[model samples]
Target: MTVTATRSRAGVLTGVLTAALVCTGLMAGIFFAFTVSVMPGLHETDDRTFVTAMRGINAAIENGLFGLVFVGALGFTGLAAVLLARSGRRAAAWWAGAAAVLYLLVLILTMGVEVPLNDQLARAGDDFARARHDFEGVWVPVNDLRTVLTALALACLGPALAKRTAGVSR
Candidate 1:
């Protein structure tokens, strides 16, 4: 390949990688913020609000729509990491890879633990009594796992991107 072609590829790779990191960071932040901000209300209430919130959350979880978005993000993030590796930024690529692994873990926890539970609850429909706190109690820790890991993944990306782009101008 010509020098110009190589340089162009590197530039495109860097931009795309940067965008992926930023997107992941934004998504993680949004996820963390929304959960933290709303969970207290969900837990503290015995009124319709709790059920309403659960309905909203459950609606999001029921058909695995959010899961699809997460899966897509994972795909793009993985591709971005691969591109970084190809550009000789092994450390950044590895860091991104690690973050991706953690993200995947979050997905697995959702699919393995949360999704099935959600499915059961959805099937219960109106019959699911408000007295039952089993879902909330059980999912608190599972959701916490996802939140913490996603936050860590977002935290790690900053340094990774910095190292990767240390000598390159945006």
Candidate 2:
């Protein structure tokens, strides 16, 4: 390929990767912060209002099928990165690939472990004690996976951004 054509392709790939990284990074941060800061407090309080909120929150977290969306996004982001890398954006590709792997593993933990536990919790119905027990035992670490995946995405974004800069310079 001509030098100009190669440069143009790289630029486009870099732009797409940058946009994806920024968006995914923002989502990860928002999710992690909400899960960490707010979800915890929901568990700490046991007043009627707190219990109501917890039940509502649990339903929202589980029944909304958020994980399906999350999984889809993760797949798209990884595919984009692969395309970018194949087109010559190695750094961005590497970052996205790493983040994708981490996300996949975390998602697996969510589906295989957390979701079933959520089912158990939901079955507890108005039995707050049983629900809380199940949540504490299983949900906390699943939530921890959320935080870890977010951090992974954030970390990957840094390298992806650097690659964009380097690609522009080259």
Candidate 3:
């Protein structure tokens, strides 16, 4: 390949990796906030208030902006891994790959556990106590797990981005 083409490809890879890092960090922050602040604050509220607030949050968080970052973290990280591997930066690629896997786990837990619980809460009628009982027990722990996974994913991306930069410098 021509020198210009190689440089262009590297630049694109860098952009994708940077995006992956940002999205992953944003996701981590979100989950961390829920873990440290939101859930705990809600936990102190009355059962009816907790159920109402959680249901509202679940509804509000389904917007386009959130979805972009939610899905983008995985997509960009996976693409960066493929691009880095293709460019012969295997070590960096592996790191990116690991980030992708970690984020995938977060996604799996969200879909498999969190979403269903949220749905049940939404349909829970006026039995706020029972709804809170059913939801909080499962949701809080799963969200904590997601928080950790997303943080780990963000951590992996740091080294991957650093390695990519070092490769460029070399």
Candidate 4:
């Protein structure tokens, strides 16, 4: 490829990688906030209040903006990996690939574990104590796992973006 073509491709890769990083960072931040503050604060509340708050949060978080960032993190990271590999930036590609895999795990865990718990909480009737009992133990731990995974994904992307920016192809 010509120098100009290569530069253009690299620029596009940079944009995609940047988007991936931003989205991943946002995901990590959200989970981290929940881990540190939201859950803990809610933990101090009564059972019914906790269940009501969680149900509200689950419903509110299902909007378009949240969905875009949540899904886009994985999409852009995977695309960045593929593009880097195709361009022979092997090391950066590997880092981005690892990030993609990590974020994919986060997605899988969210859908497989957390979402089901959320659904159960929503279906939970007037027995707020029972709902909180079932939800908090499982959801908190799983969310903590998600938070760690997302942070790891962000960490992996950092090196990838740095290597790309420094023009380190190998």
Clashes of each: 0, 0, 0, 0
What lDDT would candidate 4 get against the real structure? Answer: 0.95
Q: Could you give the candidate ranking by lDDT, starting with the highest?
A: 4, 3, 1, 2
TM-scores for the candidates: 0.79, 0.74, 0.96, 0.96
Better of 1 and 4 by lDDT: 4
Question: Would you list the C-alpha lDDT of every candidate in the order shown?
Answer: 0.69, 0.66, 0.94, 0.95
Query: What does candidate 3's lDDT look like per residue over 1-170, in tens digits?
Result: 89999889889989999999999999999999999999999999999999999999999999999999999999999999998888778889889999999999999998999999999999999998999999999999999999999999999999899888555321
Total backbone collisions, model 1: 0
Tens-digit per-residue lDDT, 44-147, candidate 4: 99999999999999999999999999999999999999988887788899999999999999999999999999999999999999999999999999999999
Q: In terms of lDDT, which candidate is stronger, 1 or 3?
A: 3
RMSD of each: 3.8, 3.7, 1.9, 1.2
Worst 10 residues of 2 by lDDT: 161-170
Choose 2 or 4, whichever is better by lDDT: 4
Clash pairs, model 4 backbone: none
lDDT: the better of candidates 3 and 4: 4
Clashing pairs for model 2 are none
Q: Report the number of the highest-lDDT candidate.
A: 4
**lDDT, model 3, position 56:** 98
